[model samples]
Target: MESSPQVYVKAPPPPETLGRPFELMDHHGQEVTNASYSGKWLLIFFGFAGCREACPTGLVSMGAALDALGGEAGQVQPLFVDVSMEEPDITGLAQFVSNFHPSLVGLIGTRAQTFATVRDFKIRREYAMANYSTKETGPRINHTAYLYLVDPDGVTRAYFDHTLEPERMALTVRLHMKRRRTSP
Candidate 1:
């Protein structure tokens, strides 16, 4: 008798990060940490309040994506962490983040703390200052732009680049949630 062909299966991808600890202050002067968000999904983004285009776009898209999730929105929390040397004060940063999404939590810290968190998350960032003698525009910042999707356990489940649309983002998040529910 002829034997049936062997079947192959692919395993699920592992988390990008096992989870990194960080301590930051919210816009409200409240302390926040990786442990603070335990038992809840986290949609984290690193950007600055001074950013004009990319930051606004990412934040708006994040709000739209969360809205698209409907009732499931409550299951995930959005966080905006400012890593700029020109980081705004707590009040300003809070206002900036809230302007994008009322539910979005804004975080800020000392230069050292911000750098440490950036290193922990493996995010790339640099200050772009224009020469004072030149006619170029004022200084700005360059940094990695990605939306990190972290599971309730704090492990990074996946990441979405700047090119992903809001609708697709919502779908992607839903798929992750489904996978987690079915996994052993």
Candidate 2:
């Protein structure tokens, strides 16, 4: 008796609805919306400046990835969206973002605006009581750490786990950029 060969099937891609329009203020206090980034790819991460580990790790990875991209980095914009409930302090935000890549932009908005953007991005965030805190230090927030890659048209093309290496992340971004150029 002869055995039949098994065939493998590729799975369908996920729906492209993870990205949506948003209006937020940049670290410089300038208002910006999703449309503000038209014609350029966006690498967006959601976290607060106060996050002790994950936020810094993700931002450093993003900065390194940008560096790896070299000239191509100009076509990509890196964004850090604050998830804290408190109103944004532009000075502090500017100072915080200065520590990372010079090109990285930090965004913040009213609580309602932040919530809407977080919901649109399908981010999961929760607040946990800190063992010790002051009026300035609110409860710690735990949130999803995936780095989202959005196309120039404001569509989410892919996402990378926070733990992924910067080199790999740069390669993945390059691959996506190539595909975008080839696709109609």
Report, for all candidates in order, the number of backbone clashes.
0, 0
Stretches > 4 Å off in candidate 1: 1-15, 86-88, 131-138
Model 1, residue 45: C-alpha shift (Å): 0.8
- TM-scores of the candidates are 0.84, 0.88
Q: Write the per-residue lDDT of candidate 1 for residues 1-184, one digit (tens) a residue.
A: 9999999998633557523778889889998897898877899889887777678889998999999999888889999999885554887787688788778999898888888888877788877664321421335677888888998877788887755799999999999998999999
RMSD of 2: 5.9
Alpha-carbon shift of residue 6 in model 1 (angstroms): 38
Model 2 lDDT per residue over 1-184, tens place = 9999999998734527786989999999999998898899999999887776788889999999999999999999999999886878888788878889999999999999999999988888988766434423456787999899998988888898788999999999999999999989
Candidate number of the best TM-score: 2
Candidate of highest lDDT: 2
Model 2: lowest-lDDT 10 consecutive positions: 130-139
Q: How many pairs of residues collide in model 1?
A: 0
- lDDT, candidate 2, residue 55? 83
Each candidate's lDDT (Cα)?
A: 0.82, 0.88
Candidate 2's displacement at residue 27, Å, is: 0.3
